[model samples]
Target: MSPLVLGPLVRCVEATSAAVWVETAAAARVEVRAGDATGEAATFAVHGHHYALVVVDGLPIGAATAYEVLVDGVPVWPEPGSPFPPPVLTTIDETEPLRLAFGSCRTSVPHDAAGNGSHGVDALRAYAMRMADLVPAEADPDGGAPRWPDLLLFLGDQVYADETTAEMRSFITARRDIDEPPWDELRDYEEYAELYRLAWSDPAIRWLLSTLPTAMIFDDHDIRDDWNTSLTWRRAMEATSWWHDRIVAGLASYWVHQHLGNLTATERALDPLWRRVLDHEGPEELDLSEAIDAFADRADQDPTSYRWSFVRDFGNQARLVVVDSRAARVLEPGRRSIIDDEEMAWLDEQVRGGFDHLLLGTSLPFLLASGLHHLEAFNEALAAGAWGDRAARFGERLRQGVDLEHWAAFQAGFAEVSRMVVETASGRRGPAPATVTFLSGDVHHSYVSEAQHSRARRRAGAPPLQSRIVQAVCSPIRNPLPRPVRFATAFLSYGVAGVLGRGVALLARAPRPILRWSYVRGPWYDNNLATLEVHDRDLRMWWARGVVDGDDHARPRLEQVADFSLDAPERSQRRRKRRAANRSGEAPSAFARRRSISST
Candidate 1:
């Protein structure tokens, strides 16, 4: 295949410049046009399934406007049947704060398939089909529908190479039998490329990505389950020759489909792969499709070689540290770190500078539910050889990349980040910590946890790195977890957690560690959407899911599952006391990102 010119991906937009990622299935001369015959055109070529990053410079600093994509002078998307024309380039208005809707683990479930009749609205598709609508012209200021997002951040699971949809399965099953070891999933670059199409090609989703400026990161499902954990896991897989091609295709295609979309201007200017794409000027000479396959193979087999994570700071008020926890892992013994030193150092620096709020976008959350946390902890200890016999073998299997989960398994790295979150929020390193909120997913559930910082862990009157920290999770957009598993997880989290599992493993010379579940303060479920608002010095979070409303396809609102507030108790308490004393309702507008009076 050639470069998939499937997109004019509206990528990063800062104050004055916005980045648009253009790709073709094959090499093609590409030019982007904005505005009337002001005739300013920036031209580049698309590499095979590889993107050519074109910075649409000198755009307006703020406000809305629509733009166009010209591939060899042809308007591909919004060519016809597009729900909305792409948004005009606007600087990321951080002072105004951001109201972004985010969630992950979407499957290619039909938007209005009668089988899923209970929930009529496919939240992802609905957002697209509704974003750019045709309103009556008499509305003057062109009063049709509202432009949906200033930005859309997709955290992870945008595609599943491991799991296939019924439609996708038909192709896979017909082309090749999946009864083999790596059956029921994707295994190579070609397959991975198709996965991306099945995922984002939906008319509604493509509509959103075309218009709403987006930032993305990948989790395990983007490739496979428990992608990279330890050296043993890598060795276990290396036993098969097919593993080489599978991983190569996965990482190579992942670079094309997702990671490239996250690169900044300077990064692309210096990018080894894309620099050539931009410089060469023609598609045939830039035949990187085969070479990138090999490069991805090397990166996956040798995790220490290349880095996949990145960081972005939205002015000084907010900073984003995107952890590439899966790709750059140091899985070797005594050298275990979810992210190698270089990536961690970069993340540390970004978080060091103070911000009103810090958003850590790791595909996996640092904090796990009490139940899940304990289970992982027990597994960690077992894997680390606290127990004897097969306990160690079992633990090894779990950690040696059994499941690509949170940091806990990589204890040293987990401890380092946990301390970072605590210290950053406590005001020890920077300001007396503002709000350190970790935004994450991939655990197949949605949740919010508040981290209470304490100075007790330290001596003296040291400002406790103890402050309120919040962790929120949203996963598997269309794939709901089983009810039985939810209950089992609850029992394991609360009941089997702590050290009893460690004791059993030990007394039988196979002691399992204790992983208590008391820390979990919320409910868990499969398939939901989580949206949050961090304003007014208070943090509020809510989770919702799709639901059929009054037998209407034309209208649907988010149905709320839970709402919780993580306010600076010190501030909220003060506000309460002052309000009572003064009889006032002074909620700050900065924090007034509100929900409807009756949350649907």
Candidate 2:
């Protein structure tokens, strides 16, 4: 058997089971051993490539268990005499608060000085180093300090099929004729497999993957820039011969590699594709090439067929609903939406309250800068024929050219999700969550925004506000926007765009946004990773980036950019209730001091 090519990656973990994904140069039976619990699964073939998802079961809930990987009964991971720490599988605990790390947009390149200088430092790698340093040099009975997060959420753009680094370009050139229409971008399954290997093979990132239980969703760049952005773009792509194969390969590989590992055991058992593979009685690695490709084709052609979006209940403590903002879109001209009605119904079902916090992970921000939000809405209106025929044509060109394909661009879809959010926040769906926060990426910058509810929602006889709605965005774990492009984005998102967007909205007769918002944290354009912690009636978030000291680009240091904390809505309500109950003229400061002492 050939050696492991990509991972012993711990993908999705629950209270009792974990999915460890791996890829090898050839077909092999892979096993994951944790304590005495062992699970083995044979590698399946896709386009001549081999991969397996080893589901390790019967794990102790809420605790970390170290695991080792074996390829055909021979140890292959934590490779013999390796210096790095052993891989660990940590299951979720119902009783404990959740701490999650999330970000998106990364490019795979060398970690040397040249790579750093060209592409900026890698924030994820820097985070891995920090996690490693948390362990003590000497062994202790209690084992090294445990500061790992409960889970990690990758918002989108985990891999860039449309963009290529120098190394990627070289590989593509060596393998095929670069003069082809697609040029430096990826072509098919083999190229995508190579891209993933490059993206996940770095020692630090690999270690991070092997330990951190992760869930991911793909954005446009995962397949191509502005994928499924508009009807115009889709028509153009379909006109090309190679585009169909590229999309099929992209979605098929995504299912085999990323999506397959995300499902719970029960969910996997229910999957039609997996059910067929698992039921096979033969003692050979299953080949899912045709089935997976057909499924991908059907999924792309009909967004309602297979739901890419899913919801996870973290033991009733928190709820994570990751929405598919790209592929499951309704891009029918004049009725464009980020998600179709079926998807919207599913999302509505998931957005109900009752958990401490409700996290909506969308690749596109639900609430962009008020200015950008209005601009996208205005563009959508024009593209929908608000303007004259010639002007509408111009609007379509502008929307496709500038990549106006976010929630804001889909007025109906945005309003629907916003209404759901308002309903949940007002406790109409269920017991209101402390916060309804949207975690997002794909704009190439990081920021946090708080929603300002519409006047109508705050009118007389409205349900009392019980949950705070906010948007938190983190992007580009490694890739950086070029200086010129960064300036253009900033101006369009925050500056001149706002002033002109309003006028355009009036001209287009665009409806007023249901909820307006403003940035409270940042619009930082750095390669960074973000972490969110839910504890002590507060939700705190921090962003960090990798920085190189003078002349030491290879050994990048992780530096904190900014951190902000939001008061949990339930906490504020409690304070109000206390004030109402205490009729006496007790000073606010006195109550605060008393509450602080009691909390301690």
Candidate 3:
């Protein structure tokens, strides 16, 4: 067997440099060659697993070049008889429009009829096939072929450590006593390594990752369900013997597998841990098992010590700020927040307006469906003893039981971020962008919502809102909610839930949300992936799902689910006037032309 175990994933690409990551069967040097540029790095050991992140520089800006991977100086990638085209690394071009693909929540399973029947087809795989032109293109309902994405942003839940599949469970059973604490859920670094292998090993998806640059941040499932929902929850987990090992390993594995590649070469050079990797020159593989575990432990205990959130700029076109909403949370009672003070300050700095578009990627949606947002707010209030102590206990139970934790649940953090967004949109921070958009996943469903200052706040003489404040969510690139649960989710997230949530909030005396929003499209429950393209002053977005034809489950084709464009402010105002003149009560799906294909 080839020494390469998993990956060769292209990550964190800039105008002239890129990072390629790989896992090897044993300690060995990994090399990447693209055009005349070549980079190599020796494998680092973490709990017996070997990995390398080769930062290739000196490539011409805005150029595309096929790359080859070699392990121990022997060509190992573009595997013999591979069906996919040679993997290419394309550097960012400031002049070109930005195309980004994003989604979250995938479970690893066999790509066969049974797997598709159980979980749904892998939308990412279908997208990869479509990009590779392995699957014949059908007539797109929204005209023209889709442009290739400059980057793939995985919002969160790249692996479900808490929800193990049969394969993961089997591996667990073979390694340790399954009947022990934590059951079949992942326990340590080795389990995490295997889980990632299962998630990324599929041929088409593997090839796709090897070519396109990717950025990732973890959500709760990356550690465990509701990993740090509250101080009470944290205390309970700390009481358990297994939680320590589980957390240490989860975070340590994340650093090796996901977080390291999220950083730009410059950022990595500034990272002390990464500096250790670069400075090491010993003959044996530089073991990071103890050092990384210590770092993860410290990071979990004090999020202020290290930053997981990152910012990337697409020249003057766009700024992508991916926030770490899980580990950086302030979970103490009476002060619960999505992110602590230090993180919030960092985010405040990064969110300044200048680019044509401002994209904030959070694992949890910043603005959820109106009703659900209110519901979560009410829960937070009740849990904070807005009612009585008895009610607080009930509220805590309900919060954990139903997964009521989100940005809305952390009111202080939500309000602060809201202020920053409002300020940025109103041009107080800098030159306002055409749109301030939040890209998120974790809801298991997809939707689009537009936010505006509450009427009263607008009357309070807030600066004229210039940018379109919108939230677009795409989730479950593979894992779809069961049919029965989908009905309940829809009900709770739409009209009825909205009314109920507001009433509950009033009863609890919860602070009224500063902004009000309405759904522009969706609440669609499909295993899908979504993309955004910057078109001058306008931004276009669309969602697509994988559809298996006949029994060719392995060769699923991409089917469009929704397509819409957010128009420039002037165009949107005119369209609104036209709708009003026609006496249309229906909410317009987009600020511009829109198209959608109903779920089958």
Candidate 4:
């Protein structure tokens, strides 16, 4: 029997259940064994590729158990002669604090000096190595429970279908003519399957997947660059004959490999395709290739027919709302929205505050730099014919060119969501959360910012904005922006871009935004992985990067870049008193960033 092609990846874990996804070399019955509890699922084929998701149930809440995968009564994972530590599944518990790891935009290539020099060292791989050689007692000096992430939220670009690695290019060159339309990039479902195989086959990353429960949402490069940015862009893509096949294959393979793994057992039960496949009663493996392919095609044509977004509540600890910002966009000429009416309505309903924290996960940051936000909103006005037909055309081109299709560019949607956030924070929607945080990626840089409601509203005896609204972004888990490009981005987003953008806005008679914010932690450009620890009275965040020590690319050390402790209302006052008492000391830059929040 050939080896397992890809997974044993733990996905969508609940208190008592966990979902494990795996891809096989051929059709087989896969079994996940944890102690005496076992869940068996037969592999389903999609265009000749086989995959399965086994729902492992009856797991004790917050218990750690060694798990193994068996294919056809033969052990396939945790290889007999494997050198790394054994993989284990740690079930989640609602009573404990939630710690989540999040990042986006990783490109899989070799981990040698050449690859590290070009794309930067892989943060995820380094983290995996750290997890493997961990000394549990040392990790927690007090001898209490150690800090292990409950889940990993992959914001986007898990696989770059549009950008091919050297290995992928070699495979493409061998099979097909490279001088053709797609060139080195992927062309069909077979190519995409191979791309995913290359991405996940790395030993360290594979081990990380086996142990960690991951939740993923796609961004542009998952399909193509600037996908569905505007009506014209969509039209241009639809004009290409190859685009149809590319999109169908991308969504189909994604459904089988990525999106299907994100759903819970309950959500999977409601899935129409899953329902049809489950209706099959047989001892043999079920082949749903045609059905999956048809569903992908239909979803591509009518995005509203299938909803990609979902909500997960952690027993009043927190609520996570992961939205599909790309496909669910309303990209008509006259009216454009980041999410369609149906999606927006669903989002509005979920944004109500009931949990301790409300996490809005979009691949794009909702709260960008104030300067950049103004520029994008200004561009939207010009594109909406505020100036005239000629300027509108120019605005449309500029919008797609600079990649300004974020929440700011869709003013109506941005305003609507902003209002919803205000309502939630002000206790109008429901009992207010301690913090409303927007966790996002896709700018290739990471930062944390806090929104400041105007003091004028408070002066007028209006209810003070009690809840903290924060934006925490982590991006480019491996890919780093070029130095020159980084300089340009910083200058344009913070300096000349703001003044000129606002001047254009005034010329076009655009209205001002409802809120303003400033950076609290960073505008750091390292390829990083970030972790968020949600406490009862504070949210602590940290970013770590891979440092390849002395001639060893295989074992890169994880180093912290920056960290912040954002306090809740009562804790903020206590922290302020402590800071004031120690005001004479010269604090670090990260701590200085925190001190500035008081002025806001």
Candidate 5:
């Protein structure tokens, strides 16, 4: 086997510099050579795994350059006779339009016929193949052309620690007792390392990561489902004999595998742990296994001590703020919030308006369908003792049993962030952008919803909204919901759930939400990936899926599922019609004909 284990992933790319990460067979000096620019770093050890993130600087702005990776002076990348084109590093240039692909909840499975028959096609893999022009011209009417994106944002759930696949289970069973607690689930850094390798090691995906700049954040399944959902949930998990080690290992691996590369050169410089790695000078490789474990433990215990949220800018064109909605949560009773006080304060500083567009990437949707939003809010009230102590106990059970934990479930956090977004849209914070959009995934479906402040707020003198405030959700890039469950989810999220939620809130005396939103497209349940492109002041987004031809599951073709343009005149007309229909009490089914693209 080659010494290069998993990456040479291009990360945190900027006009002047870029970070390239790699995992090696053993500790060694890793070097990235691009044209005349070269960057090298010594491998650091974490639980026997060797890794390095070499920051290459002095690259020309807006340029793409082919790069090669070498370990201990031996070229290891661009594997002998590789079919795909050589990997290239592309830097950001503000004048150019910014495009990015995003989605969440992918399961690692074989990319052949059996896997496609079970979990549907792997949209990310299909996209990677399409980008490389590997799909036959006959498969795509557009000639299988490539439109290279500026970045690839993995919203969350890069790996499902709790939901192990057959391959992952085999790895687990070979090393430990399968009947033990947390059975079939990951337990330590080694397991997580394996899980990541399985997820990213596919030839097409590996090549995609090697060339495109990527950023990621974690959601529940990265550790376990409903992670940090509530104080009671946290307590129950903490009481487990194995939970401590599981959490420590999960988080430690996340820092090294996902979070470290999300930071830019300047941001990494400010990180004390990264500073320790960068400033180390010795013949021996620096080992951080113990230190990383301690840090992850402390971070889990007190989220305020560390921040997982990060910001990236595309010159003055746009700002992408990826929030740590899971780990940074405050689960304390009465003070429960999606994000703690410190994180909220930090978000307040980051959510301001200035660029042509503002993008908020959260693992969970900030705005669900109006009905689902109210339902979650109602559940939150019941769990907080809105009725009685007994009811609160029952509510806690219901909240966990069903996943009633989203932005709406934490009213305080929701309201505060809503206010911040409102301020930004109304130009109280900065020059209002053309759109203030929340890009999220976790719902296992895709949709677009537009929001407006409540009439009460407008009556109380909130400025007329200048920016289009919208929520675009694209989920399950590979994992599609079961057929039966999709019907129920659509009914609840789009149908009577709104009225049911409002009535329950009235009974609980829960305060009404300050914003109203309606779905503009989707509830489509395809396993797909979505991309957004910013052209001057307008933004266009579309979802696409992989379609297998005949028996050729290994070579699925990319097919468009849905497309929407935020500032399109037709969309504006549809929004007006939707509002009129809502006021007239028309059923959501009546608006189905208005969707821009038909579901596949």
Candidate 6:
């Protein structure tokens, strides 16, 4: 009921440092501080709606040390309570066993008051509650949720204007009637600001955001499902009377809600809008309300005018390429590209001279189920009517919101990135990482796969390729596929996709699929969480989900779903440990290979 307020994203955590990037509801002299029992330390000024990255250094290294941040010297947090939780300061630890929980495709909804049940817990929300319970009875107390994550990588769907929550509806209803053609959907920047408030402002969740060092990139749902997939999709939408307004609203809102938080201080300052923002003495930094809306309109009309994707490198070992896989799409005329030549060139150069591991954070998967992946590729070619003119109609139908053309459809870019990974590993391009892994979501299932160029590698005498490729997909933090749908997907992925892909590839005169891969991982569905680790010459990983007992809605337990190590030596060591335990007849059989989903 009272006016909602937010900003100055409290994100980006690493050992001895953290970055605070924020935008305000209004301007005020903002100051940020980080300290522990040693007393006040680390402070900076934050100009209104304009963004600033205040990095705190010299943090104590430990799992249990507590830190606090001050805004305008007011100590903006739960000294006690205002229903709004204040932020907390903690350092990120890269050593020891790592724990990270991430998933996307969430729609905000009203919380069930009685705490008996809610429309299936948001996985993030659930994790936050666990953290809350772990906190000591007072601020800066002795305990909290395992010091939280070093960094939380949010892949996509941060806010959904197209799909909203009940509380969000009331905010809309109070402002304007919902009878407009796109009324149910967001129209511009203002609506987007409010939607983000609803998404991040929940007390438990807000506290988590304040504490967790978060990184994010956008996917289609952040704007709309199947956004910018094809030229026809754009053309048809432009024909609509309300299309421009919708696009304007979507783009403007996105700049504030998602992109602002992700940019480095240097990057934001480089923007023309920020110059105007810095020029203003007023509290509001960049009043993108009108500017972003206009920018979105121009972009939709000329998709190549601006680039929305970026990359961030931490230290010299890892490179995170947050790609603009949705925007800058070349969906017109002869060819379609999710990324233009300039962007691909950037990735090529970045990945070519890499470190220990290369991470590409795209909303869509590069190696999808082979059959469906091929289906999308063939459908795209057929739609272009390279096969026959009549097939174009089917292509139009597919384009009218068909989710086609992932890496398989965009084969050229896929091949380039893959080759880069190989070259990097071979030391021809750069010092090879133990693995080149892709982290993604949107597929609604989680799995890991190993890539190879030939079946010869499958045989003993075959030579090993220079580099190896792996994909890790964790999706829809809360969306569980229906039972029947799951069965259908399994059958299709394993059986149907293979049979069907061969038929289509034969028609296209394509070379027999040179890529050979296997799902030596999982299809586990649980509104799940996972962690990825890259060490000197090995990689280790695991997945987890919340567990509950019969009808008890109070406190769900943490369940370890699956665990595996990529190093053969490590695997052999673990097996030996298990054997030793068995001989002693007192070994802990913690090998839980079973996994499933939990929902309302």
Across 1-600, the per-residue lDDT of candidate 4 in tens digits comes to 555889889988888888899999998889999876789988887888888889888988887778899988888888787767677777889899898889999999899999999999999998888777764222321112375688899999999988888899998999999899888778899999998888888988998899888999999999999888888888998998689888988998888878988898889999998887678788767888788878888988888889999888877878999999999888885668899999999999999877888899999999887778878888888888888999889998998888988888888788789889988888998888888999999999999988866454555565666678999999889999999978866775564677786687677766665666778877899999988888875787888889998889999988888887777865676567657756867453565467667547
**Model 3 TM-score, 2 decimals:** 0.95
RMSD to native, candidate 4: 4.4
TM-score of each: 0.83, 0.94, 0.95, 0.93, 0.93, 0.81
Q: Which ten residues in a row have the lowest lDDT in candidate 6?
A: 591-600
lDDT of 2 by residue, 390-433 (tens): 87788889888888889989888988898899889888999888
Ranking by lDDT: 3, 5, 4, 2, 1, 6
For model 2, which pairs clash?
none
lDDT of each: 0.62, 0.83, 0.90, 0.84, 0.88, 0.61
Mark the 10 consecutive residues where model 3 has the least summed lDDT. 135-144
Instruction: Report how far off residue 29 is in candidate 6 (Å).
Output: 2.0
Tens digit per residue, CA lDDT, model 3, 220-313: 9999999889887899999998999999999999999999999997899999789989999879999988999999999999999999999999
Candidate 2 — which residues are off by over 4 angstroms?
136-146, 459-461, 492-499, 573-586, 595-600
Displacement of residue 110 (Cα, Å) in model 4 is 0.6
lDDT of model number 3: 0.90
> What TM value does model 2 have?
0.94
Error of 2 at 31 (Å): 1.1
Q: Could you give candidate 6's per-residue lDDT for residues 1-600 as a string of tens digits?
A: 111155445665556655565443343344555553322222112212333445555666533334443444554443355443445555555444343445666667654433224435456666666666555223211122234555577888777778766677777777787886667777655666678777877776677777666777778777777777777777777787877766777676666556655666567677655445556564433344456556677876775666677776655556677777777667775666667787777777777544555677777877777676667667766777767788777776775444665766665566566666656655677555656677788877788877776463346444344445677787766556666867756764674676687588668643344456667777776666666655544565666665556654444545556665665333446567766776898744656112112111
Higher-ranked by TM-score: 1 or 4: 4
TM-score of decoy 5: 0.93
- Give per-residue CA lDDT, model 1, range 501-543, as digits (tens): 4344344332222111134345566456665555645666666
Give the runs in model 1 whose Cα sits over 4 Å from its true position: 1-5, 36-51, 81-88, 114-121, 130-147, 173-181, 281-285, 397-404, 454-462, 465-467, 492-521, 524-526, 550-557, 568-570, 573-600
Of 1 and 2, the candidate ranking higher by TM-score: 2
**10 residues in a row with least lDDT, candidate 1:** 136-145
lDDT of 5 by residue, 1-600 (tens): 899999989989998789999999999999999998999999999999999999999998888888899999999998889878788888887788888889999999999888998899999988887777732212222121245778899999889999999999999999999899878999888999999999999999998899889999999999999998899999999999889999999999999889999998889989878988989998999999988999999999999989999999888889999999998888877888999999999999999878889999999999997777888888899999988999999999999998989999988899999999988988898898889999999989999999988878878887788888999999999888999878877877775778887888778877777788889998899999998988788788989999999998877888899988877334466668776877899864545555523523
Worst 10 residues of 5 by lDDT: 136-145
